[model samples]
Target: MNTASPTRKPSRIQKRNRKLILDAALEVFSTHGYRGATLDQIATCAGLSKPNILYYFTGKEEIHITLLNGLMDTWLAPMREIDPEGDPLEEILRYVHRKLEMSREFPRESRLFANEIIQGAPRIGPHLEAGLKPLVDETSTLFEGWMAAGKLAQMDARHLIFSIWATTQHYADFAAQVRVLMGEADVEGGARAHLDMMFRRLLRP
Candidate 1:
């Protein structure tokens, strides 16, 4: 007999609590990976009761999914910024620089995503198919166009993109190994210079 009413927007407190939970969850997920992370750990990190954390997110899986879903835009923005009309080498190098900067600044987010993918992305597979695949396809097409015009070296565009991702993300994903190998040198600056030089040489026509 009664009709369902519309849902109200979250209050300021609710928004703040949600952010706190997400921040805590990112730290936990990045450190422990999805399988190792626990709700109690997240609740303690967020300074919320288990029930309160559950009030914001249904469970650990939901929290992990929410954190990852939110990260997709930020993660893919460099790819999205690739301009077809701009100078091809410059555009690609700029995208590389932005990605390296993201690695330095948001390593936690980077590791969280890397962990999800390493585990076969069971939670995020659908989102990747729906959101990530199209972007990669579009970028690959642009790379192919540049190759056809002799603006870039002839190569598989998708593999080129994959190479860029692997090279740039290695700094974040294997940061500990890099530190151990590099000793006390300037890691970030050195990586930036190395990546810029490598891509410029690789992409030059």
Candidate 2:
């Protein structure tokens, strides 16, 4: 009955090779998006043969979907942190920071995800309806409760969530435009102040 393989640590070489593949896939996918990227390009980026790359992942869609699925947990975590018991302003502000940090740390993942949605989210439809919709609904309820208690500025709770998303994700989704207008130095120190001011103004009670 005890026939299951024991959990084993990845060998150092395996870990390095895996990173190589994921890094290469990120670069290719981010540049060309899922529809445009090719397995050959991804393999070249990984310094491996296409067959070798396929060993790590079965095919292009697999790698693309895998990356998106992996990114979702981290993406959803901040929203889950919305504490019903926490001060409303602070709870939302903390959520804002978590989002901003994700933009800064995982801009490529952000872009890839955006590309998927920009294409009508063909791969993530059920996930949006099932996973994200519920979280948004729950969070909206919390926001409504805050408003009823006079804890926040009276506004549409769902729209408030949308606004927070739009503001925080702007840095990643529109990064090239932002850099073009705001310049490269902006991400270094400017984003933090810009976001803080934006949220503070929006959330002022």
Best TM-score among the predictions, by candidate number:
1
lDDT of each: 0.91, 0.82
Query: Candidate 2 residues 132-176, lDDT tens each?
Result: 999999999999889889888888999888887887788888988
Which residue pairs come into collision in candidate 2?
Answer: none
Work out the TM-score per prediction.
Answer: 0.96, 0.87
The lowest-lDDT stretch of 10 consecutive residues in candidate 1 is: 1-10
Deviation in angstroms for 191 in model 2? 3.4
What digit string (tens of lDDT, one per residue) describes model 1 on residues 1-205?
1112257677788889999999999999999999899989998999999999988776788889989999999999989999999999999999999999999899999999999999899999999999999999999999999999999988898998888899888999999999999999999999899999999999988
